[model samples]
Target: MRMYISPRAPKEVLDYAQAEANDSGRHANHAEGSCFPLSWNLPPGADLGEYEWVLNGFDTKDLPSINLVPVRRDEPWETIDAHLNRFGAEYLLGIMPTLWQLEVRFHAALRRSGIPVMMVPPINLASVPSLFAQFPIHTVLTPLRYLPELRTLLPSRDPHYMTILGPSDAPIECSPGGKVSQEVHLVPGMVALFQCETLAARPTTGFHPSDRFIWEWENDRLYVTDPAARFTRLMLPRHYTMREETCDCGRTLTLTEAV
Candidate 1:
């Protein structure tokens, strides 16, 4: 699940899920969101070389229509050819900056890839109730580092933690541009991104409002606010990894950790 979730009440999501189950009365298991990112349902001992995680982008000018079946929109087809040609990409990762154009790009990307996408909405606009009348959420980013401070203030089950980055079943290196400069190995769990977007068109039972933080992506900061909704912004540097450190030329890898 992404760090930020829809602000709609959690119960509403449950009710929606209960009603959406198919003939089998089963809903698809939810994971993080991605547009054209590759997905994997690997079994133990399965060859990792069999799939690829495709990443792609599009312009806001031609956002397609994809409501119920966002994955069915027609793309130029050549868009993902590079990722496809590279091989084993069961996941499709898409980066979309426009909200009005999001649903369209998401649906088309989903349909074009025929796989699930990891959705990570920016929490840059996030704000938490202010503890001090004199200070603002904008001043809290660099100092707040653990979950206790968060739990005591926000009233949620998910607390904060140190971000540590490393490898998995295989030793994946997170940077190539110099380990310290490019590598950001965050600790386990999600990186809190406050200041999320407005009401999500679709709600899900997977997360609670208090459980996650919001982000103001454009500003690259986390937003916190007091009851008055005044703003306090914080930011944790985002972690990244290198291709060579992730998977071998013929291997598979999962881009996770403080994600």
Candidate 2:
């Protein structure tokens, strides 16, 4: 399994790891390198001083295993037009009839390299209750409420992962939607805390990209803008995507699936 620490330094990280390896060490909830430090994509955190299409490296106090892949904002209309003029075949095959080709480009690249991409969902820890309670379809990610760590799911099945950005010790579980017996409610803290290698899956049946796999959120610490306004004023489709794909409830990612 590939463990990704964060944007921290090597020596500092080593010290943390050494401590975690000790019997009397208090670093037990999660491993030192399992946590991947992430960077913000919205403005403020992302400087508007320059319009360059460049990416930044995430800065973590702990050393990260691999450099994170840069992501893009919503698929602007121009992005979609460019794709239609080029890979029209693949473009048409996409769920949304006029989605930006860049949406699927990340998945396509990762698929070719035989690696599942991880996407961090943008959500505030304080308002998490709203997310799971009124979770939207397609857009509402299927967090393996089984994992005990900080990771959460988003709309796209594009191997993209998101972090609701916050620390929580509360136990959370899933409650299936259906009849009395058909519908199931889950317990707290039952989800697996960490899965070292979840980004390994299949050749992907198709592409599923999104503007906000994470509900376009608020909270400067976790999301880009004010989520309350985004959700309330926006007339977006919950899943947002115009298509769907099959998934394994237990299996984490299709591209990073264990063969």
Q: Backbone collision count in every prediction?
A: 65, 34
TM for every model, in the order presented, reads: 0.20, 0.19
Report, for every candidate in turn, its global Cα lDDT versus the true structure.
0.26, 0.24
Off by over 4 Å in 1: 1-73, 98-100, 124-259
User: Per-candidate RMSD vs. true structure?
Assistant: 23.1, 18.3
lDDT of 1: 0.26
Give the per-residue lDDT of model 1 (tens digit) for 1-259: 2222224325444344334433336322111111212222334574545322222212222234211112212322232332334333454433223342343444454456564553322232123432222222111111122223443654532211212121111122222221111112111111222111111111210101122222222122222211111111222233322111222222222222233
Best by TM-score: 1
Candidate 1, TM-score vs. the true structure? 0.20
97-172 per-residue lDDT for model 2 (tens digits)? 1111233543443344343432223234334334434432122122223223323422222221211111222212
